[model samples]
Target: MFLRIFNRCASTATASRPTSFTFPQRLNRSPTAILESLNSCVQTDGGNPAYIFMDDPFLIPTSGHEKRQLALSKAS
Candidate 1:
């Protein structure tokens, strides 16, 4: 799920030249941390995928493709 999100975001950044928002120097400073967060969210919600938007909107919104990818991942 996370890999898919990263790929989508990277692809979007490559395809669109628009300078709308500057991405962070790194998406998540630590992949382990993000994974941990996802796991915690899952545990809290009975294995549901984490939508870490309300907590950190800026971190998650730009990659619409990511959300879609995650949905697809969930569906599969």
Candidate 2:
């Protein structure tokens, strides 16, 4: 979660600040509201693992359906 910006100030006055320096980049200040955002696409699928075709009932995770949901929200 880090961004590196490399710039060469042409003069000493530019490097030294008399006023506050705003970051040339913006950071995502919002923490994930849920743990599902970090998981793979499959984990968030909302389906019954028990009745599903999968053999190991617990092999697949059935949780939040927000994997692509978040992407669409960001687009708007």
Tens-place lDDT per residue, model 2, 5-73, is 223433555768677767688666557634455554446446444333254544443444543454455
Output the worst ten-in-a-row residue range by lDDT, candidate 2.
1-10
Best by lDDT: 1
The best candidate in terms of TM-score: 1
Q: Pick out the ten consecutive residues of candidate 1 with the lowest summed lDDT.
A: 46-55
Off by over 4 Å in 1: 1-21, 44-76
Q: How many residue pairs clash in each candidate?
A: 0, 0
Please provide, for model 1 over 30-52, each residue's C-alpha lDDT reduced to its tens digit, 9 standing for 90 to 100. Answer: 75897888787864554433564
Clashing pairs in 2: none
